[model samples]
Every structure is written in C-alpha cells, then in structure tokens.
Target: MRRTLDRLYDGALWLAAVTFALIAALVLVQILGRLADRAARAMDLPPPGITIPSLAEFGAFLFAGAVFLGLAGTLQAGGHVRVKLLVRALPEAPARWLGAVVSAAAAALAGFATWSSALQALDSLRFNSVSYGVVPIPLAIPQGVMTLGLALLAVALVDSAVTLARGGTPAYRASEARTEADTEASTGESA
Candidate 1:
C-alpha cells in the first residue's frame, strides 16, 4: 500500500512536469513561428500569419493543472512550507501528538477541497460547460484534475497522521531530517 501510494504521488508529479514541459514547448513553438513570420515580412514576402489561436488560455489551464497535480508530491517531498519551530522544540511525545493533530486537520481540509472540486467538475459536465476561448476546452477536464490532486493530498496527509499517531516518523518529517542533516554536514565541512 505504501509503495502504491508513493507511486501514485510520483506519477502525479511526473504528469505535472509533463504539463509544464508542454507549456514550454508551446511557447517555444510560438516564438519560432513569430520569428519565421517576422523574417518573411522583412524579406518582402507575405507573413505566414502564424499564431496559436488561444495560447494564453491553454497556458493558464495547463499551469493550473500542473499546480494541482504537484500538491501531493510536494507534500511528500517536504517542499511545503511548515512552521516546525514549535514541533522541534517539544519532546518526542508532545511533538508526535501535535504533528498528528496538525496532519489530521490538514487532511480534513484537503478532503473538503476534493469533495468540492469533484462536485464542481460534475456540475460542469452536467451543464456542458466550456471555456471562453477560441478552442472550447471542457471545464470539467481541469476541474477533474484538481479533484484528483486534492484527493491524493488528502490521502498523504492521512498517512502522515497515522504514522505520527503510531509513533513512526512520517515521510515528510524524515525527509526534512535528512535535509537538515545534509545542510549541517555541508556547513561543518566548509567551516
């Protein structure tokens, strides 16, 4: 189960990376197209009039998808901002309890977001909603992606809570520890 969850998060992160790459690719192509058009115009040739129909809209959608898809992976990787000063200052038992409580609360919020986004997606589907761009993108598609990401994030948070409650170090906490240790080692070596 742990392995499966890890894979799921990794896959989502991979998909997010792909989306970002696609955005970059689109921009590159657009730039190239404009350069070609400009060169043609400069050479007394008809401009190809090359342009993406609704690049800005597509970019916005892809960016939103990428962000939503990255949530779980970022959390698992300890990339999310957390105020850990209090937790670190406490003894093991109290720190564990506090962490568990915080994780549970975050899980609840994630679950709510998932539910709400899913509902919105469903509603969009039912209404046959589409984006107001030259290319009519189904609004449900991006909303569904958001829902999936929120669901994964909720699962990760629940996993963290359970681990902390069982007196086990959560993946994020372990990752943070390793990062801190590495930083300290690097500083000591430099000194």
Candidate 2:
C-alpha cells in the first residue's frame, strides 16, 4: 500500500512535469510564429501573421496545473518551505506533539480546499462553463485537476499527522535527518 501511494505521488509529479513541458513547447511555437512574422515584414512581404490561438490562456492553465499537481509530491519530498526554527528549539516531546498538531491543522485546511475546489469544478461542469479565449476550453478540466492535487495533499498531511501520533517520524523529518547526517559527515571529512 505504501509503495502504491508513493507511486501515485510520483505519477502526479510526472504529470506536472509533462504539463510544464507542454507549456514550454507551446511558448516556443508562439515565439517562433512571432519571429517568422517579423522576418516576413522585414522582407517587405505580407506577414504570414501565424500565431498560436489561445496560447496565453492555455499556458496559464498548464502552469497552474503544474503547480497544483506538484503540491503533494513536493510536500512528500520535504521540498515545501517550512519555518522550522521554533520547532527545532523545542524539546523532543514537545516538538513531536507540535509537529503533529501542525500536521493536523494542515490536513484540515487542505481537506477543506479540496472539497471546495471539487464543488467549484462540479459547478463549472454542470453549467458547461468555458474559459474566454480564442479557443474555448472547459473550466472544469483545470479545476478538476486542481481538486485532485489538493485531495492528494490532504491525504499526505493526514498521513503525516497519524504517523506523528503513533510516535513515528514523518517523511519530512526523516528527510531532514538525512540532510543533517550528510552535512555532519562532510564536516567531519573536512576536519
């Protein structure tokens, strides 16, 4: 089950990567189109005026998708920015409890966001809402992707909270420990 969950998280990150790649490709096409037009005009010829329809809108959607889709994986990988100074200052037991409390709060907030986003997506789907652009894309598609990402993030937060409650270090803590260990090793080697 753990392996499956990890794979799911990895897949989500991969999806985000693919979305970013698509965005880059679209932007490249748009840039090339503009350059071509400029070249034609400079040659005193009629510009082809070739442009990617809805490129801006599509790029925005893809960028949002990439960010939202990467959330769960980022959290799991301990890549999310966290203010750990206070937590590090605390005693072991207190820090553990504090971490658990923070995780629970994060889970609640993420769950609420997931539910709200899902509702918004459903509403868009019901109304057949489409984005205003040269090409009309259904708003629900991006909203659904956002909701899925939020749901995954909520699950990860909950898992971390449960692990902390059970006296197990969370993945983020483990990652930090590994980093600290490596730093110590390097320092010792230099000494």
> All candidates' TM-scores?
0.97, 0.91
RMSD per model, one decimal: 0.9, 1.9
TM-score of candidate 2 on Cα atoms, chains taken together: 0.91
lDDT of each: 0.94, 0.91
Which lDDT tens digits does candidate 2 get at residues 28-126?
Answer: 988988998999999998988778899889999998889999998888888899999998899988988898999999999999999999999999999
Give the best candidate by TM-score: 1
Question: Could you give candidate 1's per-residue lDDT for residues 17-103 as a string of tens digits?
Answer: 999999999999899999999999899999887788889998999999999999999998999999989998999999999999999
| Candidate 2, residue 55: how far the Cα is off, in Å | 1.3
Taking all chains together, the TM-score of candidate 1 against the true structure is 0.97
> For candidate 1, what is the lDDT?
0.94
